[model samples]
Target: MKHLSRLNKYFLKYKWWIIPGSIFVVISNIFGVVPAQVIGYAVDLITENVHVYNLFSGFNRQEIVYDIFSSNLLYFGLLVVLLYILRGLFLFFMRQTIILMSRHIEFDMKNDIYQHYQKLSLGFYRRNNTGDLMNRATEDVNRVRMYVGPAIMYTINTFVLSVLIIWSMFDVNSKLAIYCLLPLPFLVIIIYYVNTLIFKKSGKIQERLSDLSSFVQERFSGIRIIKSYVREDYTRNMFEIQSNEYKKDSMSLVKVSALFYPTMLLLIGLSTILTIYIGGMQVINGNITAGNIAEFIIYITQLTFPVTMLGWVTSLVQRAAASQKRINEFLDIPPDIQSKSNDETEINGHIRFENVSFTYPDTGIQALKNVSFEIKSGEFVAIIGKTGSGKSTMANLMMRMYDVEQGQITVDGQPIKALNLKNYRGQIGFVPQEVFLFSDTIKNNIAFGLDQVTDDEVFDAAKNASVYHNIIDFDEKFETMLGERGITLSGGQKQRVSIARALIKSPKILIFDDCLSAVDTKTEEDILQNLGKIMQGRITILIAHRISTIKNADKILVLDDGKIIEQGTHNELLSLNGAYTDLYNNQLLEEETKGI
Candidate 1:
């Protein structure tokens, strides 16, 4: 309830719909109960007519009495039908008002949740699984809508109808009404018990559902690996185990739910019995008419459905609260990284890192140590290092994906963290080592970084990346759509497309982080030559391992472990005959032996 109480704002936001819908509930119930009185009246009039007919044995007199009774019954029947129609009309109005509001609220909440998700930092994603995130956004939000729509609507309906029905019963015959309602307190006790059980189990069921969803998502994403290992049967068995556990938990809940309705019916049946037996006795004593007994029964029957719905409404609310709690957990989290200032300062070519040190928080592994370097205007600097030597870490720092622990990174004599995050990153064209492309057309993929781009711009970027001819050869040309992660494209083609995406941005600083590894030397050289035409007045940092890739760079820094061991021009590094020389010679030997 505390978690559900957090949704008061939505209620207030849609109060106009709710307030009118509540009035309609009351009005509809008023119309709904009027027919019971009409039926009772018809019963009394018929009884009187029959008694009069019994007193006169003449055939013509009996016929006249029968005619009067038929005419009276028809009038009452028409009135009852008219009342029912009125009730139904308001019911429709009720749904249009309240239910429609729920849908609107659902839309707003989903957007809010998604917008918040996009603001969270990389560390948050690393800490949470995709299944849990998706469950909260999709499945959880859907359950919350049930509470807002059906559960709440039914609750109000049950309350209003119960109040009206019980009041009418007591007004006609207080003593009989008390007996008929004797089973109600017991019903309350059972609903409380069911609510407790459902609240407890609902949370567990959702957690298990998240687990199941995550398992299926991850396995499907890696289905190719499963087939490669020839372990489809193993994966199927694992999925069966998960599905069986879900079924078991769900059945346990269903078993509890099964107990609820039967017990409810038993109590309802008891109420009906009391109305009949007790009201019959009252009629014998002349305290009430038999017609009144029929009326009490009709009233009890009307109340039956609403009272029975209490258990279902309780279940919906419990599930909704559990789901909303999960959603709120994500909503309440503040991003670990955000811009400290709104200043969208222009980035110059002067980028510097002073005594930077950092560790990956998730793993607590030190990725960089006292790394200091500077890139002046139009400098083409290449970083070469072994795996885990912090080559990628430097690129991450430049992008401000994470902040340094010991020192500061500055752009144009300002702390990088102080700049607006969006504006700062917008100027840097970064092609990560692990390339990713959306399942979209080739032209759209190339121009992904921009809001709008012309066909000529897309072609030019593709040409600069040396993939223009490959794309033009496709049957769909630029319109050809790729599969998931661009799986339809070959490795080299995928890398080239990623480069084109970065190149299309027309950035101030270009960081190509080992993105050319998939392509051969000839294509890589062609791409670099094409890039040179537009490389003026922009700082370029290339991180790669192959000596041939960085041989013509203005400067090269060799990293060993987390520290820089050597920094010089390509010729100067060879003269030193250090780590750089050894790496260059080994690659040169391989190329020569292969007759390249």
Candidate 2:
């Protein structure tokens, strides 16, 4: 109930719909009970006419009977039909209002969840898996919608119908009504006991579903590796096991859900027997007429459907609460990374890391330690390091993917956190080592950084990244849409397209994190030369493993195990008998040995 309170705002938002829907529910239920009363009245009218005719009528009685009963019966039957037709109309309006409101709420909720997903920092994604997140958004949301729409609708119908029918029954004879409704308190007891089990099982079933979804997603995403390793049978068996687990949990929930109908029928059956047996006695004792017995029977019949719905509605509320709790778990978490400043900071092409240090929140592995560097405008600064030596971490910090734990990063002498986070990121174009591209056309991939771009600008960026020729040779050229993550392109082509994406932005600060690793030497050199021409007024930081790539850089920083070992020009680093000198010689020998 507490978790579901989060949806109250949405209810308030769509209050107009609910108000009319409630009115329709009351009016419809009113018409609903009136027809039952008509049925009872007709039964009495026919019974009294037959009794009077048998006692005092003669041979011409058939004609008299037809004249007296015909008009009266016809009028009652027509009136009953009209009442039902009116009820049906209001029912339609009720659904249109309440169910439609639920759909609108579903739309808004999905948007809110997805919007929050985008705002969350990288660490949040690390803490949660994709499949669970997807399940909460899709399956859990759908369950909640059931509660809002059909469950809510039926609940109101049941309450209104039950109250009117029970009141009418007691109005005729309080003792008989007690006998007819004696089984109801037991219904409440059954609901309370079953609710706990249903709620628990519902949560477990959803968790298993999330697990199965995650397993399938990973298997498909890594299908290539699975085939390459010839592990098809192993993967198949693994999936079978997970699928069976999901089936087991689902069956448990199904079994609990199946219990509702039988139990409901038994209680309703008991109530019917009690109504008939006690009302028969009342008629015999002359306390009430046979007509009243018929009315009591009709009232019980009227209450049957709503009473049956009690179990169904209870299960729905429980499941909805479970799902709502899961959804609230994510919604409650405020994104840790937010911009404090309202205005975008002006770019001055100067960046400084003043004793900055950071540790990965997911693993707590310190990736940088008291690192400090400064980049002036128009400088081609390169960072060289072995794997896991914090070169890429520097780029991540500069991009503010994770805030520094100690010290500060300043852009144009202003603390980076003080700048508007979105605008600050917008000014830098970063190409990570692991390139990812959307399934989109070649032109759109290159121009992805900008909201609007000219064809010539896209072409120019592609040319600079040395992927223009590759794209043009394709059948659809720039209009060719790639597969998921741009799997249609070769490794080098994908990397180049990624670089082109960054270059298209023409940003004030550019960071390339060894994004050219897959390209051939000639293409790499061509791309570098193109970058040199564009580097006139930008701060370019290149993270590289290849010594040749950074040999001509204006400044080079050597990193070893999360700390900078040396910083100087490429020639100046060679002059020192240090780690940088040894790495350069080793790389140079490898190139020579390969006949490069």
Task: Please name the candidate that would achieve the greatest lDDT relative to the true structure.
Answer: 1
> Per-residue lDDT for 374 in model 1?
86
Model 2, span 1-596: residue lDDT tens: 88889889998999999999999999999999888778778888988878766765666876687678888899999999999999999999999999999999999999999999888888899888888999999999999998888888999999999999988888888999898888889888888898999999888888888888888888887888999999999999999999999899888878877887788788888988887888899888988777778777777777778877878888888899999999998998998788888896658668898898889988989988998888888889999999999998899888888788899998888888888888988988999998998988988888889999999999999999999999999999999999888899999999999999999988889999998799888999999999999867788999999988888899999998899889999889989979989998898799889995
lDDT against the true structure, per candidate, is 0.90, 0.89
Candidate 1 at 112: error in angstroms? 1.3
Angstrom error of the Cα, residue 55, model 1: value is 2.6
Which regions of candidate 2 deviate over 4 angstroms? 59-62
Looking at candidate 2, what is the lDDT of residue 255? 87
TM-score of each: 0.96, 0.98
Residue 500, candidate 1: alpha-carbon lDDT = 96
Q: Write the per-residue lDDT of candidate 1 for residues 1-596, one digit (tens) a residue.
A: 98887679899999999999999989999998888988888888888888998877666788888888889889999999999999999999999988998998899899999999988877788888888889888899999999999899999999999999989998899999999999999999999988988888888888889999999988887888999999999989999999898888889899999999999989889999999999999999999887898898899888788977788899999999988888888898987778888776677768998999989888898988998888887888999989999999899889988888899999988888888999989999989999999999999999999999999999999999999999999999999999988898999999999999999999989999999999998999998887777678888899998988888888898998889999989999999999999998898899899995
What is the Å distance of residue 234 in model 2 from its true position? 1.1
lDDT of 2: 0.89
